[model samples]
Structure formats: structure tokens, C-alpha cells
Target: MVIKGGILLAIRYNSHRYTRDIDFSTNQMLGDINKDEIANRLNKSMAIMGESL
Candidate 1:
């Protein structure tokens, strides 16, 4: 996954901004969407980073 746009900059500087959007991308196609798996991965990653969604 890749992060871009204002959210990335905000995270880099730890500054408050009005942007309320997050954008991510992947190089390869995801054949099927897995809600549970995605949520688990996201939660785990956020925990590792001391953050939450």
C-alpha cells in the first residue's frame, strides 16, 4: 500500500489540517475484497504504530 496527498504530509509534520480524506494504493490487483481480513490487518498495523482507525 502507498499513502499520498495531504494526509501523508499531515502525518509527516504532525500538524492539524482540515483534510478529512485518506488515499492508498496497491501495485497489484486485489482479486477479491475481504472485509474481515482488511479490518484485521488495519487494526494490527495501527496497533503496531500506536494508532487506531
Candidate 2:
């Protein structure tokens, strides 16, 4: 996921005020993912939050 906006900038440098949510984006095409692969990748992503792949 590609983080952007105020949340991303705040994470980079601590902010006195910030939003309560995180915003992210991906270059993935959901239509191309198969069911089995989708389950596998979802679990993998959940296991590795905040870590670069």
C-alpha cells in the first residue's frame, strides 16, 4: 500500500495535530486476483502490516 496525504507526512515527522485515519493506495488490479490467491495474499498482508514487502 502506498500511503499519502497528511497521515503519511505526520508519520514521517510527528505532528501536533493529525487525522485519526490512515490512507493508502495500491497498484493492484482486484479483478485479476483468483480466489485462492486472494485469500493467501490477504492473510499475508494482514500479517505484515507496517513492514515493507
Candidate 3:
């Protein structure tokens, strides 16, 4: 996955831009993506951070 848009620019250059969203991309096709697995992983991560979706 690649991070794009304002979030990337802010992190890469330490810019002062304010961004409210994160953008991601993958080389895999949409049909090949596993939605449940992704959701599970994200849930686990959020749990580790004491948060939830």
C-alpha cells in the first residue's frame, strides 16, 4: 500500500498543512482484496490502541 495526498506531503516534508483523511492504494485488483481480513486487522490494531471502529 502507498500513502498519498496531503497526509503524505505533510509527513514527508513536515509541512504545516492540516488534513483530516488518509489515502491508501494497493497494486492488487479490487476483486482480489479480502475485506474481512482487512477489517479484522484494523480492528485488532484499534483494540491495541484502546479504540474501535
Candidate 4:
């Protein structure tokens, strides 16, 4: 996934804007992927990083 929107702007440009959520872009189409599986994987990754969904 690629990060975008307010979060990206804040990091890249050092903007002071506050954002409550993250935005992402994927190369695969939504219809071609299992969202639940992806969510599980992402959650696991976050857990490994000491973060949570």
C-alpha cells in the first residue's frame, strides 16, 4: 500500500495539519482481493511493530 492524503502531506511537507486517519492506495483492485485476509495481515504487521488496529 502507498500512503497518501493528509498524513503524507504532513510528513513530506512538514505541515501542521492534524489528521485522524490514514489514507492508502493499492496496486490491486478492490474486487480482486480478500479484505478480511488483508486486514488480518495488516493487523499482524502492526502488532509486530507494537501498534494495533
Instruction: Spell out the clash pairs found in candidate 3.
Output: none
Which pairs clash in the backbone of model 2? none
Best-first order by lDDT = 4, 3, 1, 2
lDDT of each candidate versus the true structure: 0.75, 0.69, 0.79, 0.81
Taking every candidate in turn, the Cα RMSD to the unseen true structure, in Å, is: 3.4, 5.3, 4.3, 3.7
True-structure Cα RMSD, model 1 = 3.4
Q: For candidate 1, lDDT tens digit of each residue in 1-53?
A: 78777877888887676278777787657776666887799788879877543
Evaluated at residue 46, the lDDT of candidate 1 is: 72
Q: Which candidate, 2 or 3, has the higher TM-score?
A: 3
Off by over 4 Å in 1: 32-35, 51-53
Model 2, global lDDT: 0.69
Top candidate (lDDT): 4
Count of backbone clashes, every candidate in sequence: 0, 0, 0, 0
User: Looking at candidate 3, what is the lDDT of residue 10?
Assistant: 80
- Residue 27 CA error for candidate 4 (Å)? 2.3
lDDT of 4 by residue, 1-53 (tens): 88788867876899888497888889998899898997898788768866522
Q: In TM-score terms, which candidate is top?
A: 4
Q: Write the per-residue lDDT of candidate 2 for residues 1-53, one digit (tens) a residue.
A: 47677866776787655687766666778676465975697678768865763
TM-score order, best first, reads 4, 1, 3, 2
